[model samples]
Target chain A: MIEKIDGFAYILGDDINTDDIVPSHTLTMRDVDEMAKCTLEFIDPTFAKNSAQGNIIIAGDNFGTGSSREEAVYVFKVLGIKAIIAKSFARIYFRNLINLGIPGIIVSWNESIFSKGDNLEISLNEGVITNKTKGVKIEFEKLPNFLTKILEEGGILNQLKKTLKG
Target chain B: MGYTIAEKILINHSNLKSISPGQFIDCNIDLIMVHEQLGGRIHKEYEKLEIDYVWDPNKIFFILDHWVPAPTISAAQMHQDCRKFAEKYKFIHNFGYQLDKGICHQVLPEMGFSRPGMLIVGSDSHTTTYGAFNCLATGIGATDVSVVFATGKLWFRVPESFQIIMSGKFNKGVMSKDFILTLIGNISTKGAIYKSLEFHGQGAKNLSIDGRMTISNMVVEAGAKFGIFQPDNKLETWLVNRTKEPYKLVTPDNDANYENTLEYNLSEITPVVAKPSNPGNIAGIEEVEGIEIDQAFLGSCTNGRMEDLRIAAKILKGNNIDPNTRLIIIPASKEIYMEALREGLMEIFLSAGAVVGNCTCGPCIGGHLGVLGSEEVCISSTNRNFKGRMGDPTSEVYLASPAVVAASALKGRIADPREVL
Candidate 1:
């Protein structure tokens, strides 16, 4: 279950790809903990250094596009990013994140209103995001019922295991 | 009722008759290839299905590229998994760090694994590069790959075809990279989603086999199922030199109908780059010149061809890379590496203070080598320059042609290849 979190927002522009989320160089390391130390080193080195665990990421269109590298999704999960709200997502990335049990919401309207460091409250179950600073509230289109069930089960792999075993 | 090169191949191989868009039907896969990274997962997934042997090991090709020579223990584990899988299944083609082992797409055609009128699937997105030979190739998920392993066939929706015809001649310093980027800009990235793109025109004949591969390599970025150019004597000659197997030639019928047709005059094309955040966010090199860059990379299945090396070498022959720049060269395959050595392109790059690395994908994926630091800016030849693409979210990556990357390496800033060439 996703809980409402009041955290600082890191506003990113459109098309934040998987490569930027996780560098390919770190793929050499097997430990997710060690690799997470350098997450977002290209975009903000301090991101890995100073980021509080479970920060919320708000982005524009086409998030997680480019090279279906699963490591890209894995890095964010390891970095403790709570939820990613974007206007839209690349098809494979959306699936991969859901499979990894990451909460990704697609909010089509008022995406530009939220900026960096805004104190935002998100309710995953309600699909509502309220920006207290801007006095704006946005409703995200929830994942389909079937996908919600998969996410609840902790990812597609776990879901698959359960289904196969049952 | 029109058929594209991708559609025709799918129809001929379709288990059912007369398939259309949105209707998925199982069809046999002519080739199932995987690299070190995803191959291990495929094997593990296969184990879950309790499969002793793959449907047709002969048609499956496994390579230890990507993180090969094992950059770390995890990467080594991936290789180990692939090695065991290959041995257990008796897969016909298993390549390590030796000769014939390179980027799957490059070595596949170089060793004649791809042919006209065939359907190929790989775990990597650039698998569409095989479509340059008029084959239908696309990437699939790991579970889907397991399904393909258990059965020789997987299902696909018949994609509509978009015909792109290019005429006129290319301007000086313009390359295939520019032409393809121009199309992405014109059509938008998702403009051709789930469609096969067929390139035809007198100007296409002007491109070499390697150039054609570079153009088709990034078809996935435009959300297309694949991009293909009809085969000609150049492709046939290359295939004949590599394999002795009988090959078939296929093309769209003279009256083949297309859902949409677009024409480009090649002469109007200029050196282009996809600015940070999106591949479709394109601008000509002239528009962004003098933007300082911290890195320059020349490799990837896209621009890592022998001809791409020659272009970069020619530009860097006597010029030194800017002290502020970190330039790295990754040849697509071992064959390209040896050929570059024989052609003295390696010396030119080395003399320019550039680091020449092995045939594996390096900084392109932001893996081991060439990780960009925060606030750094890079000009690279690899497809895709989305935000945080090369390392730091603060660092920026600009995608361009080999010549542009080489020129940028020399100047420590994004540049027009025409200035150096």
Candidate 2:
């Protein structure tokens, strides 16, 4: 019963690692709201400042690479990021994001298809994103069947909790 | 078919009768370690299962190293959670802020916890450093760590072995860090994914134990499972002096089969540095000479050994640091710190205007101290020089050996160590 998300895109270049996603220094703050304000503070000082809640982010290959830090994923979730579309992802980062219930899609389209401020609509169930402003549509690899359940339950820990409770 | 030391160990400890290269197997774990930074979440996950006791407390070790002497209230809370878990579960191997407590990787081997041919897993990436003792070690995620904690078995694919042979003496100013950086350049970052790297040759034998640790520590940079050199008399002598535990000497058989073989002439390797954004982007020091540096740091599990300090001392003796630069030195372990103090290495560093700190993984992880400012440049002896790795995302980090970093600290620009030494 989840609604589809529509938003302007924030396009980033390649190799966005965990450090840029969430600086280690700000990790001292346990509050999700405070931490999200500083997310991607290193890469774009105005990222949190300029971003509206529930905005979509699209990036080139090898996004969210480096360190298994979970805070990097949590910060994005707290900031209300609708979905992340990347050409590819580092194995660990991809797993981490999926485990945290953050919608991360892997699209094979050329990065040139999307640009900043393009109005994009993402359908989690359909696994397709349409750049409405550019009249472009891109398909992504569907999440594995088991991972869909994890996302539905709001992450691995929550899924585990449900299983234990039952 | 003869077997390499790694193959022999995997077969011996493995539940499977025979595991060929590229085959997956579920193996028994001898030790699983965690630090405070990641332990809280892992412990929370374990609590959800409502397990009464860990699978085996003796096989598990937790140390409060990162953010130890807790840098913040939240870090202190993380430590408190770790303490509660340790106390409740009777985790016998837990070490707090005692004299023996230091970096987990440094202390694990020192306390006779790791033996040759054993499999070790930890929550930190640099756990692969235990491979210096001929152990199969790698890092895992918090969930994987919790799973290993609940069950002393983890699944892994038996990786194909890469035979790397080296010969000839290392050129002056080129240390083990430079040698490893050159190897990573040749292999690229993902070149050795899911493979075992076995170092063998006259060149490897010539390296000191500390230098061997430096090389083995960064195997993760090349995406290798582990890096191991056969244990020899030097290792035997060092281990005997350090611990009373008996360890079996192991080596690869003469006819052992390898998936690939790579040969390097040590004399041909120059001072190498990994450029920003990727550890695989390597270049010679000469290629990037005169690149200004705001800081030069000599520490990390990779280059913070005693031998690394002695070499830096030899180069920095009777010299002052560049007026524009800040150089920080951190010993790898408390034992190395005590030894360096006895040998007056500290005075040599302090007299040269360098700041020497405790034996912790500081600044190397960008958690504390020496965080670079925007547009700042740093030459470091630590592994992994990815962009924003040191502090500022815009700051540039150049990876080099202790010799290169020490020399650059004096010159205020990236310079070859041989020129100053």
Candidate 3:
């Protein structure tokens, strides 16, 4: 659905869990935008104030490795995250990204590929990630056709709506 | 070629008669279990789809375990919303604080909703606890659960499975919790990412259903999609009185494929604890002994069963917790709580300076009850020890079995269970 996502890389370390993304206590908040303010508060207290729209989050292995809370993914959406490129991801977290129409690209484990604030352009169509700042190009696998179809429909809800209407 | 238990269950649940790992298929779910998030988030997502009614009310388990007794006004509103949804749908298995239900994972199995060869999904990650019954179960997000409600089907990628062969027996004061922690320590948190962990062999067979549930519940910490056990006479006997529904049992066929194989001798395992920040950061009891703790929490879906309470009570009997340390005890369900009361375990706990709370997933998730403050350190029987997991980000949590927690509470430090026992 989203052929390309161009943004600056927001770097995080390995094993960034769901708890880091959305703390459990914050889930009680009524406003989504207000809840997003607590994203990664412990890891980077300024993540809420510093992160801007369309920034790509690049992290090491097992990103989003705790809990099945979809609020973790919803926080990224509310913050306008363009895409997440991690060396790996926990299963439920990755699926939530796909269902919410966010591209979660899995790149090989190479922490040296991008630095903080590096301009990166990910072309989902070509399966290539071009670190425009560093002049490096990396190839990754595209999402399966079925999953891409869900993304194209703007999320699982839209896809489900189509199915139900039919 | 023979099929693994996961493959067998998926094949039986889906239109396909056969499936290989990584092949995605639409599977019919036998049950969908949801908790507070159902009212808090899932209802909004489900409303977006504009479906008038859920596919089948009978197939849903509407539970309000987390934030039960509504810790805050916001949580109370969420409970009200869940009540509205349950009332509208008339869910057959609806439960709330009023009904005196505990955690969703424990209640589902105790209610017999978790049966052999069934495929279950829950909004909570520990839903994998049902796999102790030899069923295929995994956690899903709110959006996915909403879609399943609209149409009782969802997509699943057939996961590659690992065969964990457990041999030998446990030493005194050691538990299934210790063995599971050892496995997670050897294989880091993401070792089983997107894979099924099929547990079997002598050590696994020797475990009681409660012990098996404790093991299966936290396999998600290893990033496993499912933690299924092979059906044995223990599970069969346990299910006979719980469920009258005719059910089939599934076993991994001989010569079934596995992504990898791991063998563990449970007898060699000793009391272990996962230190601050991560469940994979395991240390022997002796390694972290005498490390002072501010609190000792003994509850959660992971280790809140009667078996766990009995273990903790045995250690706490005739002994009081340290003056500096606070101990909080919560059973996983009403049944477990009643059983503990009948056994006088509640009396022992109350006399031991432990604040026995109602059955709720309170402090384990840092939702309420025993939330830790900044600079506070706790020894908890719950699964995760992630930073900020139990309240303030600076608060540190150490994960261990209930026995370890009880000993730590008695000493006001991370003490060895062997000493207390």
Candidate 4:
């Protein structure tokens, strides 16, 4: 439901799969904080140790492939990831982000534009991603108006609640 | 313009009749399936809403799978929660632990609730497996599942179609699993990303309903929204005795527009494996043949069917399992387990010194049973060879068809099934 957020950027590479997002063994705890400790530990052993709250993640194409585990998106939500901008997203990952009310923006791949800890800004309504550090901008294709309404409601749960009451 | 199978089904179910790829529309859901793991989460949300019964209990089904019989205290609690919810709602249910007939994907069809030209959604990615029967199925998260429960509605952005044309025929000991794995190898993991894969061509038509399932189950590994085939006599025969529910059969028009059309000749299909850490990281069996493994797993939503068990049994008969390897056979559902037992496939597995696990996902999700220890190497029929997929991240997972898995178990190496078959 909350929109127009700005944060520093965190960059990860292509096909950073579900296992890397949260290992299967760590799923015992649903507490966001407890589960967030293992975030991306499968691939980057140092990620959990280095996560910064309010940082946005910019990923390469096919981000969040493998396994339909939502922990991948859950940890980021807990960590307060401002938004995610990717060249492309695996279908279920994109769906999970929408259901969770996370801003998932798709942009064409540009290696020269971003570096870890860069200044990033997204205009959700306009579908534009700007890298302030490099002074570059990319236009993203707009999502359907229906999904935009859900995201504006801060995820599907709130949307469902409203629908049920009505 | 003509429409693909997925588009046709989505259009029919949506509030509107005409739609295009990338356009979002709300549609009525035909079925909602969930397991204990997800059902527990949905229960919490359902309570939070304070609803009066469900919108339609008959449209929903619960399965006590994913750590069947309760592998841990928490798992037991989750299963109990699912059971309690099912009891309160009196929804259609299948508990593998009690009746030995669960595994939502396989059981739904085996029991015949799913049908051609339907819009199905589940909380598990392998829900796409239902597409083999020509239905449009996809996976979503717990929150989405909860929404569907509150209202029998969900929204989808129609996906563009990626048509895969499979022609020719299977080689000796080669099956749909092998060709599909090979196709994944060539396509890479993200090749299909958000698109739907509509399978066609003579090669696909020649595959048994079981074999088509093997192909559809892993389409998610290639980043596909769904994988499906045209309805055939094979599926009709399987369904004739199971249900009399009136349903429609949908086929894409010949002039259907495709984002891209990929053609493959199945006669050239080779035995392959998705090396550890990636399902798309494939290599020919000859390249990795002599590599030894610590375990061999033959089951998952991807393979654990009667045909897969029969394939493994056909290769394992009389030949003992290599003492160096641990082979675990987990049938997909209770019906498959019972069918295997009736066919005497269980005796062969026992004689081969394989551990016959229950009708559950078992170690595929690393929930329990057959978990690989650190540094262990495993050849499996399960989908997704992601890092630590079967157990330890340091351990290696090789994705193969049941034939290769069975043969490798007998040889203690990644040998092709043809060597033994």
Model 4 stretches with alpha carbons more than 4 Å out: A1-3, B94-99
Give me the displacement of residue A132 in model 1, in angstroms.
19
Off by over 4 Å in 1: A1-16, A20-63, A70-166, B97-100
Identify the candidate with maximal DockQ.
3
Interface RMSD (Å) of candidate 2: 3.0
Error of 2 at A56 (Å): 7.5
lDDT of 1 by residue, B285-396 (tens): 8789999999999998899999899999999998899998999999999899999999999999999999998887767766656878899998999988776656666778
Model 1 chain B: lowest-lDDT 10 consecutive positions: B37-46
lDDT of 3 by residue, B278-377 (tens): 9999999999999999999999999999889989999999999999999999999999999999999999999999999999999998999999999999
Give the better candidate number (2 or 3) by DockQ: 3
RMSD of 2: 4.0
Name the weakest run of 10 consecutive residues (lDDT summed) in model 2 chain B. B94-103
Q: Sort every candidate by lDDT, greatest first.
A: 3, 4, 2, 1
DockQ, candidate no. 3? 0.86
Clashes of each: 13, 1, 0, 3
Model 3 misplaced stretches (Cα beyond 4 Å): A109-111, B97-99
Per-residue lDDT tens digits of candidate 2, residues B41-64?
577667876768788988888887
Per-residue error (Å), model 3, residue A41: 1.1
Error of 2 at B7 (Å): 5.1
**What are the per-residue Cα lDDT tens digits for candidate 3 across A64-155?**
99899999999988888889999999999999999999889999746568888989998988889999988999999988999888888879
Error of 4 at B300 (Å): 0.8
Worst 10 residues of 4 chain A by lDDT: A45-54
Off by more than 4 A, model 2:
A1-12, A45-64, A76-109, A112-166, B1-13, B20-24, B243-259
Per residue, candidate 4 scores C-alpha lDDT tens digits across A1-166 of 3466678878888888888798877765646587887888876776666667327888998988876767788788877776888888888888889888888888776668878877878888888778898898878887777778878987888877776788
